[model samples]
Target: MKSPSRTILIGGTLSAALTAPVVAAAAPATMDVTITIPQLKVAEYHRPYVAIWVEKAGTPPKTVAVWYDDDMQKNEGTKWLRDVRQWWRASGRTMKFPANGISGATRAPGAQKISFSRAQLGATAAGEYTLVIEAAREVGGRELLRIPFSWPAKAGAGGRAAGKTELGAVTIAFR
Candidate 1:
């Protein structure tokens, strides 16, 4: 004796499955930032305190990096963070010192690079934004540069700006 073969029809279920639009997973958002601390010839040269951030119209700024004197006794380094005036007034005053991942020791005069992932950027809306880099040094002039870019950035999309006194070339790229 042999068993009879049975066939089952999924009907609408099968049709719906085939008709549903396929959504590909979105690629993770990533960004690379570079800034230059031009070596200066002056009577007194102090490492510039630097701050990098992004801002959209009508929203608070999001700070990406802050480089300052982190080795001072009694955490005195934090006191001077305000010297980077634009950043201090925009977002720095509300933040605590030594913020993890965002705070680091000042870099040497050259191109300094840092990268950020979606998580590091927090909840960012898809729209226009400006990358702001500000640098201030003791007994030295202050400089600030801004570069405009779009969020959910297109691959290889980037922008650059040059500073005159305290800072040098500043660039930002999305990947």
Candidate 2:
């Protein structure tokens, strides 16, 4: 037979162990996103600089990814990033370049798929949030698009938005 204190402790531990999975199951959901950058037929065509981020109500925007001209010298690419006006004003000014897992070289005009685990999003609490995508090009145009969705999104929930000039199609799905 166990001492009363030991028995109580074991019971409490067992209870916590059983509840662990339940708590994890209730954690924030993950997202899969695809950003399409359309190729334009222009003499001065330049790959557009793009930024993707998430914003929760009453919270500052958090960058998910940024695509820029990483080939430039002396981190010159970062200077053009601010052309993405909204993202620049929101979180770009203070951020260092090449943010791990959140910055990449510009992609060719096509579908670029990206996945965001709960941890990548900072695991926002159960609530509504907005996904914002902005695009700008040197000697070109600029555009911004936004998609709103709820947190802990139901399986198979997804959305897409289109841009007029600098950007193309933006799609997001939660799982």
Candidate 3:
């Protein structure tokens, strides 16, 4: 038979085991973004430069991704980032080109996906936030779409927005 002290120790260990999952379940959620670049019927089609970011009221926008021509000499690619006007004005100009972990090459005409953990997004506050995706192509039109969502996401929470020009259907899903 086990002593009283031994029984209490076993009970304590079982209690901690039971609570471990609950703590793990409460960890921050991840946000997955799917950007669709529609196939345009044009004589000269250039993959659009894209910027993805999140914005909250009275707070600076948090840029999640910037897709541009990183192959240019002397980082000349950054010069054209201004074409994505809204993002350039809001966050791009102030940032260094080829931002680590946030910069990548332009994508082809298809669905491109990027995922962000709650920490990567820097969205610590729990409230309403908007996901903004802006795309611009050389000699082509520019388009921007915004999808609103909440932090510490609700069950089955997500949003989608469709663009008519340089972009297609953009979606945001919380996991």
In order, what lDDT does every prediction score? 0.77, 0.77, 0.81
Candidate number that wins on lDDT, 2 or 3: 3
Best by TM-score: 3
Model 2 segments more than 4 A misplaced:
1-28
Local accuracy of candidate 2 as per-residue lDDT tens digits, 1-175: 1144235435544554577857545542457788888889998888889898889878778998788987688989888888889999999987998775678888888898776755456544777888888999889988899988776676664788998777778888865
* Candidate 2 local lDDT, residue 112: 83
TM-score of 3: 0.84
Regions of candidate 1 where Cα sits further than 4 Å from its true position: 1-28
Each prediction's TM-score versus the true structure: 0.81, 0.82, 0.84
Backbone clash count, each prediction separately: 0, 0, 0
Candidate order, lDDT descending = 3, 2, 1
Q: Which has the higher TM-score value, candidate number 1 or candidate number 3? A: 3
Q: Give the worst 10-residue stretch by lDDT in candidate 3.
A: 1-10
Angstrom error at residue 19, model 1: 22
- lDDT for residue 105 in candidate 2, whole number 0-100: 85
- Number of residue pairs clashing in candidate 3, backbone atoms closer than 3 angstroms, sequence gap of 3 or more or interchain: 0
Among all candidates shown, the one with the greatest lDDT: 3
